[model samples]
Target: MAPGEKLDPLPDPFILQPPAFHPVVPYVTTIFGGLRAGKMVLLQGEVPLDARRFQVDFQCGCSQHPRPDIAFHFNPRFHTTKPHVICNTLRGGRWQAETRWPRLALQRGAGFLTLFLFGDEDVKVSVNGKHFLHFRYRLPLSRVDTLGISGDVSVKAVAFLNSNPFVEGGSEYPAGHPFLSESPWLEAPCSRALPRGLWPGQTITVRGLVLPEPKDFTLSLRDEAAHVPVTLRASFADRTLAWVSPWGRRQLILAPFLFYPQRFFEVLLLCQEGGLQLALNGQGVGATSLGQQALERLRELRISGSVRLYCVHC
Candidate 1:
């Protein structure tokens, strides 16, 4: 990227079957095939309630005593009155000039999601569904071989997502799996697979507040074969709340409708035998039959409407 050029949110890259990391504290994991552009790493964890700071490092290797060359250091300091994300590189036993991004994207004592998008010019990071920081590279991508995170943080999972293939049968899109852009949180026209992979008993919850007097919103769940098993539609335009296949041969399902304009609410779609159950805030809204396809085959969630979605979890 040119100096001072704007870095927009990264477009969705193809995701492989997310390899999981459930490491002990002071974690260090090697990147077996090395890092490059079009690859991203997802770190999910919680900062301690009393966390003063924590650090994540992209190192040349996982060596200690005389630590390996640090290609990128991400340190978030909470000790100061105003928090900042500190970025730097270490080479020849000296630290480079540090860059501070004045954003405290991590929440105290709560889980946070951080995505590091690797590119030729810089590494852009997003935290908890929002853009956080970026750091220009001071080392070639070739030298980095390990990833480490340490200090006052409880890590839940670390996943390395590589979109471009450099080896035979590498971590690319699986043959039969449905693929699409990763969902941009709170952004309409959003869609992605359930990150942990959907299961039979899992409940998919979408929580959002309507943007003051919203006209309409729609959320859909689809199977691998492109079958939309269940779809929820809320429209003030037509004064209707309906389920999928409105005009198709399949019958439509309607719920005991209620509206909370300009207020927060959650829609829970639970997968179970016979059909999908819909619940608003905690009570049953309705049920819609999605045929007899296996639960594991339901692979995608698509949401697009005039609303700001805060969370979608299964």
Candidate 2:
């Protein structure tokens, strides 16, 4: 694809399946897969109270899989609490459960069981054979401090099993998951060669917000077609970037917002002479103009190599 060309939409990575049960302890454990690969349930502990007992639970999707995938329950009534599950998908995103199970009854001889089942288009939960909660969408594989069960029972086993192929290989958070360092601002790299055609008065503006960080980073805009790079420097200490017009000027101030490594950032570029406009995610902060001087000489716009995640005008 040409520089600045649009990209296709992201695919869903969640697999559907029946619910499963498992046993767990007070420590953080993976009820299913590693990292954010398949379906993973995480567990933790919290303050103890004199209320009904509940077993913390983590559930997964069931649109594809037909069997109970995984489960984890804690032992030692008040001795150990705070269990959670980290539900993840093959693509990205996560959900967490941390509510205590209400003081309820279970099937005779049945201990407190935390279930993760796939129900219709949502993920449902049941404790001691009693229905509790349901999630409408697939949860991404991320860390969460939620997942509680309340009842008059104790946890026993934390099992992991799946009858579906789609949900087997993917883990909740595999050890080899890709990692991107934290940054205050990011920019999509430009192409090396400018477009072949030319049109005077053609202009494009690239804009984005500054992330919340202690230091500032340089935002570089490259005209891949022209093989040029324009750099903008800004700070993310305050966490905001507003729009600043750069007409007939070299640099402009964009919006102001705290940088969040977990959230999506945006950038906007307007191409008037060409009758086109492009907005991108991860384009970096600040504002600037690609005036008729150089934009008129370009044919293609694209993000350079290894410059971080890039999303086209969405």
On lDDT, the candidate that comes out on top is 1
- Residue-pair clashes, model 1: 0
Candidate 2 root-mean-square deviation in Å: 18.6
The RMSD (Cα, Å) of candidate 1 is 18.6
Per-residue alpha-carbon lDDT of candidate 1 for residues 236-296, written as tens digits (9 for 90 to 100): 5644667756344333445433433564455677666767777664345567765445456
lDDT of each model, Cα atoms only? Answer: 0.68, 0.34
TM-score against native, each model: 0.50, 0.26
Q: What is the lDDT of residue 223 in candidate 2?
A: 49
Which pairs of residues collide in candidate 1? Answer: none
Off by over 4 Å in 2: 1-193, 197-234, 238-258, 274-290, 298-307, 310-314
For model 2, state the Cα shift of residue 195 in Å. Answer: 3.4
